[model samples]
Target: MFKIKSLVFIFLVFYSTINYAQFTDVINSNRPGQSMAAFSVGKTVIQAELGINRIIEKDKDVDYKAAIWNSDLALRYGVFFEQFELIANLEYQNEKFTAPGVDIHEGALKKVLIGAKYLIYDPEKNYEKKPNLYSWKANHKFNWRQFIPAVGIYGGVNANLAKNKFLRGSDIPRDEDFTLKGMILTQNQFGRYTFLTNIILDKFPSQRNSIDYVLTMTRGFNDRVSGFLEIQGFNNEFYKDHFLRTGAAYLVRQNIQVDASVASNFQASPNIVFAGVGASWRFDANYNEVMLRVPKEEKNDGKSKKEKKDKEKKDKEKKKRKDAVENTEFK
Candidate 1:
C-alpha cells in the first residue's frame, strides 16, 4: 500500500511538471514575475510561507539577470482527539529589485493554512521495538505498542498581488500583475514510528501548477527527547529543488518545549546555515500556548514540579518498606 501511494504521488508530480512546461516560453519571454504565499492549518500543526521571484529584462538590454527573494515562517500545534483538531498558520514575504534605473516591486501573501485531521483505521496492535536517531541513552528503545493509522486530508486557498514598473527614455509602458492561488496538503502517519508522508499541490493565477512531496521520520528518545528529519521535493517546469532538515526537541517541562534545527538546500541558491531557539508554554489549554522561555532555560528544566513530587513519593515509600522489614526481622 505504501509503495502504491508513493508511485501515485511521483506520477502526479511529473504530470504537473509536464503541464507547466507548455507555458514556459510564455512565462519566460514576457519577463513575468511571480510571488507566492501559503498557509496551512491541520489537526496537529500550523505553518505559513511567502516567496517572490522576478526576471528583469527590457528591450535592447543584453545583460539581463533574474532576481529572487523568499521568506517562510511556520508553527505546529499537536492535538489528539477522536473527531478532529484545528491548526492555524500565517506567513509573509517581499521581493524587489531594479536594473538600469528601472524600479520593480513584487510581493505576495505567502501563506494562510487552516484544516483538520480525522481518525481512521486505528487498529490495536503491537510490534517489536526499534532504534531511534535521537535516543539519548544507548540502551533506550520503543516498541510499537499501539497502532493507529489515521487518514485525513487538509487544504486551503489564498490571494497573490504584485506591482512592477519600468522606465525607458520617459516613453515606456508599466506592467501590473495580480494572481490567486489554491493549495492542498494531505498527510498520513502509521503507528508510532513508521512511514510519514505529505502530498502538496497548488494552482497559480497564471495557470501554473506545482506539486511537491515531503517525507519525514520521527524518533523518540526516552520520554523527554525526540528527533526528526525531513526531506522535501518540489517539481515544476521552471525549477526543481530539494531540501533536507534535521531537528531535535526536548520537553523542558509539562507545558514547555525547546527545539532547534539545521537546514540546507541542495541547490545553488543558498545553503541555509541557521539555528533557532524556540519554546512554548501552555496557560489554560494546551492549544492556547505561547512561546515563553529561551532554548537554554527550557533545555535545563524539562521536569516539572509534579514529576519531582512523584519521584520523592516513590523514594519515601521504598524507605518505609525497608524500615518495616528491618523492624520485623529484629523483633
Candidate 2:
C-alpha cells in the first residue's frame, strides 16, 4: 500500500513541475526550502507555514514507515534598530511510528525557538539609499540581494516540549531537551538565482555538541515562482551525516506561498525517500513602519514627484483664499 502511494505521489510531483516552472518562497519561513534567507522578516511582519513529511524504508528483514505533521509559525519584530530583528517560532509536531509488529502514534508541541538576527552588512546599491521617514507603504522594488553576499548573525535557544511522547518509540537521534545554537548566515543573488549558506554550532549540555552546514540555491522562473536545490551536512562528537534535497515553490499572492519537496540520504539508504508539502504566509502589521523598504533609486524618484505635487496643491489653496477675500471686499 505504501509503495503504491509513493509511486502515485512521485508521478504527481513530476507532473506539477513540468507544468508549472515558477516557484515562491522566503527564507523567513524556511519551509519547502532549505536555505534561511539572509534578510530579516522585516519590522512588524509574521510568517507561518505548515507541512507533512513521510519517510519509508522497506527491506526483506525490516520494514519501517514514519510520518510527521508539522506546523511552523514565526514572527520577526524589528526592535531598537532597523538592522536588528527579534525572532520567535513555534513548531507543533505529530508523528506516527510503524515497525514490524507495532504502531505508535504521538502528538505534542515539539519546540519553541526564540532568537535575534542582526544584519551586519548589505552592499546592494538600493540598500545604500535610505527611505525618507514618511514612506509608510512598502517599496517592493528594493532588494538587499546583490552579487556579494549579505551577512547576518543569529543566536537562539530551543525549548523542547514533547513530553517524552515520541522519543520512546522513535529511532532517530535528536538533540537534548534544551539546546543552544549560534549561526552565521550569508546569502547572495546572481541574476534571478539566490544562494544562501548557514554555518551553525549546537551545544547540548546534556548531549554531545554538533555542528551543521546548509547550502541552498534557488532559481526563479519569473516574479511569482522559484525552485531550489539544497545540501546539508552534520558533524558531532559521535556521528557524521549528509543529505541532498530539491523542491519547488509557488506564490499564491503577495503574502502567501506553497511548496513541495523530496529528499533522500546522500550516502546510505538509497531506497529510502522523504517527501513533504507545505505553505507559508507573510503579512505586514498595521503600523507606521514595516518590512520592504523602497529602493534608493526609486526612493529618490518618488520623493521628487511627491514634493512637486505638494507644491502645486499648496499654491492652489493659497490662490483660492486670496481670490475669496478680494471678491468679498469689493462687494
Candidate 3:
C-alpha cells in the first residue's frame, strides 16, 4: 500500500511541475526568461506549501515506480528590535508503492526554531560619499561587516497511526521516530557585495544523518533589489551519498521572491532540476509623535484660581464657628 501511494505522489508532482511551467511562461511574457527572486524577512508571517515528485520506468524484464508528496504549514514571529525570530512548523508526507502492496508513511509537528541576526554595516551609506565612482564601477567594493554568527536548533518526534485491519492485526506495529536539526549562518560585506555562508546538520528517525554547506555572493542592485548566486553541497551519511546544488535568487519586491536551482548526485540517484517561488509580507508601519508647547500662565491659571477660592471659603467658615462657641460659653 505504501509503495503504491509513493508512486502515485511522484507522478502527480511531475505532472504539476510541467503544467506550472507552462502557466508561468504565459504570465511572465514580458520577462526575458524564468527568473527567481530572493527571500526576505517579516515581523509576523504564515506560510503554507505543497509539493510533489514522481519517476516511473517500465520494461519487458524490469519495472520501477516512485512518488512523493509533501505538505507543510508554518508561522514565524520576530522580536528584539526585529533582529531575532522564532518559528514553528507542521508537516505531512505520503509515499506509496504499487508493484508490491506496501505502504510507508509519517507525519509530525515538524520543528520549532529560534534565530538572531545583526546588521553591522551598510554600503549604501558610503555610496552617498562617492556617488560618481561607485555608480560607474561595475563591481563595487563595500565595507566588511559581520553578524554575530549564531546557530538555530530544533527537535521533534512523530508516530505512525495508520490502521491495517484488512491485514492481520498483528502485522501492524506502532512505531515512533525522532528528528533534530541545527543551522548556523553568517554574512559579511566588502563594498557593494556581501558574502554569506551556512552550515546545517539534520538527523532523521530512520537513523540517517545529513550535513550541508552553502556559500553565496550577494550584490545589492539598489535600495529595493538584490541578487545572489549560491553553491551548496550535502552529504548523507546513512546512504553514503553526496549531492550538490547551484542556484540564484532575485528580489522583485519587498514581499515577492523567486528561486531556481539544479541539483546533481554523487553515489546516489540521478541528477534532477528543481525551481521554487516564495513570497513574504511584513505589515510593519512607522509612526512619528509631535509635541506642542503652551504658555505656563495659561496652563496653571484656571485650576490654581479655583483651588485658592475654595481654601479661603473653608477658613472663613471655621472662624465663624469658633466665634459662635465663645458666645455660647459667655451666655
Candidate 4:
C-alpha cells in the first residue's frame, strides 16, 4: 500500500511538471539571428551566445570604403520566474577606412546593452489542442488560434561608451552617455516552421533615436539542423536601410549550438555586406522545476465512477489497517 501511494505521488509530480513547466529538455538560445525569441530560458538557467563578423561597406556619396571586424557576446539568465529573463549584450569593432588620399585604422566598443524580458502571454498554457479522432479533415483543418503568437516585452538601457567609432559623423546628435531601448517580441510555430518578429525602439529622446524591426522565419530540416531567413530594417531620422539575411544553425549537443549567417543591404550609396559565425552554450545545472496546478476538469484520467469507488474503498481499508497497527503499537 505504501509503495502504491508513493508511485501515485511520483506520477502526479511527473505529469504536472511536464504539463505546466516552460523549461525545455534542450537548451533554447537566440543565436545566428538578430531577433529575440519570445520564450525565456527556464528558471535558473544561464546561457552565453558569442559571434564574430566581417563587414564591408562602400558609400557612393562620400566616396569612402570601410572594412570592419566585429565581435559580440550576449549573456542571458532566467531568474525570479520562468517567464522572465535578464540579458546583457556587448559588441566591439575594429575598422579600416580608405578614401581618396585618406586612410585610417580604428577600434572601439560599438554598444553595450543590459535588459530584461518578460513573457506576457503564452497560448499553450492551460490549453491543449487534441486531435479529432472521428475525422481526419477536422484534425488537419486550420485553426484561428494559430494566429495568436506568444508575446514578450523587453526593456533595456544602452551604455554610450567613450570613443565609439560609429557615433562619430552621424547626423543626429548624441550628447548623452546612456540611452533607452525597448522591444516587443512575438513568435509563432507551425509544425517544422517558426516565425519571429521584433519591434524595437532605441536611443530614446536623442536625435539619433530610431525604430527598428526584425522579421525572421526559420524551418527545421531535422532534429539537429535548421535554417533561417531574416529581414531587418532601421528607421531613423538620418538613416534608413533594410537588410536581407540568411543563416543556418546546427545543434552540437542539448546545450550547445553553432551557426553562420550572411547579410546585405540594397542601398548603393552605402552598400553594406557582412558575414558571421556564432555559437551558444547553456548552463542549467542550477535549474529547478516548478509545477503548476492542473485544471480540475482536466484531472479526470478517464476512470469510471465504479472504478473510483473501488479505489476509495481500497484506500479506506489501507488507512484502517495503518491506524490499527499504530494503535496496537501504542498499547
Reference-based TM-score of each model: 0.45, 0.66, 0.45, 0.83
Candidate 3's error at 322, in angstroms?
66
lDDT tens digits, residues 1-331, model 4? Answer: 0000000000000111245555766666677878888878878999888888888888878888888888888888999999999999888878788889978888877678899999898876767566667999999888788678989999999887844455436454654688999999988776667788999898786877889988888877876888888888888877788888888888889888888888888678788888888888889999887754243334676455788899999999999999999999999
The segments of candidate 4 whose C-alpha lies over 4 angstroms from its true place after superposition are: 1-20, 131-133, 168-170, 292-300, 303-331
Give the number of the best model, judged by lDDT. Answer: 4
In angstroms, what RMSD does candidate 4 have relative to the true structure?
A: 11.4
- Candidate 3 Cα errors over 4 Å, as ranges: 1-65, 71-74, 94-176, 190-193, 204-206, 218-228, 246-253, 258-262, 267-273, 285-331
lDDT per residue as tens, model 1, 71-107? 3333333355322434333434343544566556755
Q: Sorted by lDDT, highest first, which candidate order results?
A: 4, 2, 1, 3
Give the CA lDDT, 0 to 100, for residue 71 in model 2. 55
Local distance difference test, candidate 2 = 0.60
lDDT of 3 by residue, 2-58 (tens): 111110000010111111111111111101111111111223332222223232312
Q: Clashes in each model (backbone N, CA, C under 3 Å)?
A: 13, 5, 31, 0
lDDT tens digits, residue span 81-131, model 2: 546777776766667778878798887776677888887865542344445
lDDT of 2 at 22: 13
Candidate achieving higher TM-score, 2 or 4? 4
